[model samples]
Target: MQMKKVKIDSDRCKGCQLCINVCPKGCLKLSNTVNAAGFQYAIYENESKCTSCGFCFLVCPDVAIEVSRKAKPRVEE
Candidate 1:
């Protein structure tokens, strides 16, 4: 089975928290510290359980979230 990963771009984040709310796995959380842009952004705490559903990425208006899955190898006969 392939695993999923979530990446957050703090620079582009606007502290919307939309991705946090949309994530079904509840892996996303808001950071207490602000970034260079002075915005408190969301972060992924529990990345191991990420489903790579892209819900967070889809809901993020700032386009800060990136979801990707590991490519599985094909079986050769």
Candidate 2:
């Protein structure tokens, strides 16, 4: 299985919700906890649904989101 990860820099986020709106997999959402800026930040909420599409990263005005994918290791026969 392929592995995908999304990292949201809470400190840099300003609760814009742009990343959440653009996420194709619905993997991102606003957190209840506010950052130091006193604004809710987007988080990778659904791990299994993420496809590393990079839409969230592209849409973020604050540039606070990062998306990554790791290929599954090969198995020897």
Candidate 3:
């Protein structure tokens, strides 16, 4: 399985939690730590369960979440 990597911009997050609710794999959670804007940010939890489905990214009102899949290794000639 391809590993999914997610990057979140915590400063821009408003703690809306829309992304957290929308994650199918339960990969996101609200952090206890707050960002510079005084809002709790979304974090990727249980990363091994992430499918790179992009539900979190699409639902983010803050556009804080970015998800990418790890590329598969190429077969050498």
Candidate 4:
């Protein structure tokens, strides 16, 4: 199984909690600290539990979230 990672671009975030509320896994949460834009954005805490479903990325209107599925290594012949 490949590992998944979620990257948040705080610069583009608009502090919308839509991603946080749409995440069925409940892995996303709003950060207590404000971003440079002076908006409180949502962030992922338990990324290990992420299903790589791209739910957060799809819901983000600001295109702040990035979901990547780590490629598995191939066996040498």
TM-score of 4: 0.83
Residues 1-77 of candidate 3: C-alpha lDDT, one tens digit per residue: 55448889888889998988888888888999999988888887788898888988888887888889877799999
RMSD of 3: 3.7
Which candidate ranks first by TM-score, i.e. highest? 1
Write the residue-wise lDDT of candidate 4 on 1-77 in tens digits.
64348889887888889999899899988888988889988878787788888999998999999898867799899
Question: Native-vs-model 3 lDDT?
Answer: 0.85
Instruction: Please give the range of 10 consecutive residues that has the lowest summed lDDT in model 4.
Output: 1-10
TM-score-wise, the better of 1 and 4 is: 1
CA-RMSD of model 2: 3.7
Q: Lowest-scoring 10 consecutive residues by lDDT in candidate 1?
A: 1-10
TM-score for predicted model 2 compared with the true structure:
0.83
- Write candidate 1's Cα lDDT for 1-77 as tens digits: 54338889988998988888888889999999999999998988777788788999888998888888877899899
Q: Which of candidates 1 and 3 is the stronger one according to TM-score?
A: 1
lDDT of all predictions = 0.86, 0.84, 0.85, 0.85
The true-versus-predicted C-alpha distance at residue 55 of model 1, in Å, is 0.5
Better of 1 and 2 by TM-score: 1
Per-model TM-score, in order, reads 0.86, 0.83, 0.83, 0.83
